[model samples]
Target chain A: MNDLRTKLMEAARSHSPSDAVPIGFEKQVMAQVLALKSTRQPGLLRAPVDAWALWTRTFLRATWSGLGVVMILSLGSLAVPPSDGDDSDYQGLMVDSIAMPIDETGGEIL
Target chain B: MSLLPEPSAVPSDLELVHAVRSGETERFEELICRYQARLFVMARRYARREDEVEDIVQEILLKAYTRLETWRGDAPFEHWLMRLGTRICYDFLRQHQRSREITSTELSGDEVDWMECQALPDGRADGKADAARTLVARVLDRLSPASRLVITLLELEDKSVKEVAALTGWSVPVIKVRAFRARLEMKRLIERLDREKYL
Candidate 1:
């Protein structure tokens, strides 16, 4: 029995796992897991409130979403294309109003 | 390396999971540090080459991260990792078998007896122990990866059938059958060696 146990332990001892992962393996794994979050659709809100009622509510939401698509399509058709007339003012300027650089004097913004 | 951490490290594996879910990185590192050895042990049984085992373990770690958002946390974290490791090992074996890379070498007494001596060390016969140990390692190399895994985990690790079944995703019947066949094969090898007057 002692021999058997010793044999078993010896054979088994070779199976011990090695330790040497990236210093921050958990962070890396979590980062990958977090990436999966974007692909996951959020669970239904107030899921199946009352099976029949929930079905009706979902139907309504679908109708609303379809209507939203139609509305955007209509609005998109009404928009005008941009004109070249606005390009001259910005092309001649050394800087734009929102993006001025600090001057060497530090007192002035150019 | 030390097996367990100091008692004051923090909370349980679940607490670490909660931290991970809350987007804290430290808890996740703690979780990995906590499990790396256990995972390596699991991976060792699946892969034939030590390097390959390490690779498989790293792949499993990557898989765990990618699949973790689905964790329901209804079970222990170690249990989940155990299951993951088992499944990964099972899949690795299945893939290897499917690839048809089985070695054609015949089993010999030198391999079996040496393996027995190294592993069983019964009362320590010191004169030839080193030679026996090497022979045993060589003989083990002759076994199929799946056989090595089942034998190591079941006979050596002392994991129960239910635990193995759960970890391996194999129904209890399959694990039983595989373990039974693996042991029978080992016994046959030993008997053959004895008949050949090598023992």
Candidate 2:
């Protein structure tokens, strides 16, 4: 096993790749690097809004949510029926009464 | 920026790194030229094709460039670069393993002959040496990526277990286990080849 291992190592060391870097390889790599640099926007330039923008964004978001709450409450109010306290009492009184005497001449319940 | 440093006044790796970090981007080319050959040699071990080797080297360089600011200049630049290169190689091996199935294909007549030659006393001849390398590559292809990497570092590169650990960031025990497993795997592969050749 040791002998085989040694032989394998020997073989590996002896073998070398035949491939060579093509001509102008460095030039090509540099060109690519330069192109990448040119296309990249500087971080400072890209970050135009800064802390002020963050503050504005947060304020706008808060305002929108507050406005949404108000709108929802208004809609809820519209969904409910309007009430007069006296009307409820009157309804209750009519429901409770079984019968009332009739005024014969006027044909009205008193 | 002032006039660029003259070629005669070649800067240290750390200085070059600092220059590149401080907006003197052109200095990066010097770093590339300085390490290109060594990086190419290291990359070739993992990549079978020329194009693949070149691609790996380019990727390594680009990564080094983008992460230059992270280097603390504590160790030699080459040492850090070597560790990075090994990591890249390991990743490539893992990806390759995932994408391809390991087939137990029969060795060709020439390959069988090469295997047989390795056992002979005079197998150190130039031609047989080449065949041996080809056989090693084929066998390595059959191994799991982890096993192949362990074997390459332990056996082929003659790295100590500690050194392998340092390069791979694996624990010493893990490196030892992987090395043992890799040797067994390689032995089985070679034995299978031998059996097939005889049959």
Candidate 3:
């Protein structure tokens, strides 16, 4: 069994080394290398976004979204009339105050 | 006293490495041209397809170029590049193993006959050599990537366990274990082939 194993291994090892490099393989490699070099951004300037950067970006995005929601809510409140039934008196008072004419002549004692 | 080396003398790999590190990027092409054939041959041992072989060679060259600074002048540049190449091959094998299953088809009668002929002492000729190489490749395809690599390095390339360890970043004991497993796997594969051929 050992001899057969050795013989098999010898047969396997006897397989000739393949030196048949495809034509233009070096040129292809050089082209790829050059392309990679050209496409590669400088490490310092274009390093991959780290955890800190990603966190900051996410935080900023969330903050901006929250601000947008707040702005929309504020604008929505301003556009819609107050729905509280108890504020009817205050609303009437506001209308009356706006309707009151401004005195154009010298102020008279009230 | 003459301060300069002879003009006719070839620059050593270390000298070229220094030139490359010193901003002589074009000189890298010289290194590439010098080592491309060797790297291709090494890649071929691990890669069955031509495209894969090219990819391995290209990757090795790109890595060696980008990491030139890491190469201390302790060993010959060729040896260093070879180590890098071997590691890349191992990685490729591992990746391939993960992505695919290894299945062995039974050898046909003609193929078995060819294998028998090649097994003879004097049957190694031009066409037969190619066939034998293919047969060996097919047999190797049935092994796990690690086993295949171990057998290829130990049996085919005649590398020692220590050498494989250094090349693969595996410990000596690990290499020994893998080699043993690889040999057993190979023996089983051969036995199966022998049965198919005779029965």
Q: Top DockQ: which candidate number?
A: 3
Stretches off by above 4 angstroms in model 1 are A1-110, B1-11, B22-27, B97-124, B127-137, B191-199
Candidate 2 at residue A51, lDDT? 78
Tens-digit lDDT track of model 2 for B11-101: 8897787677767778888888888888887777777988888888887877677666557778899888888889988998988874222
Comparing 1 and 3 on TM-score, the stronger one: 3
lDDT, ranked from best to worst: 2, 3, 1
What DockQ does each listed candidate score?
Answer: 0.12, 0.15, 0.16
Clash list (residue pairs), candidate 2: none
Q: Which ten residues in a row have the lowest lDDT in candidate 1 chain A?
A: A40-49
Compose the digit string of candidate 1's lDDT tens values, residues B93-194.
Answer: 766653322221343444444544544435344554544444444444445666656776786678898877777677888888888877765555444443
Where does candidate 3 stray beyond 4 Å?
A1-4, A44-110, B1-8, B98-105, B114-130, B197-199
TM-score of each: 0.55, 0.69, 0.66
lDDT of 1: 0.60
Q: Could you tell me how far off, in angstroms, the CA of residue A28 lies in candidate 3 after the best superposition?
A: 2.8
CA lDDT of every candidate: 0.60, 0.75, 0.74
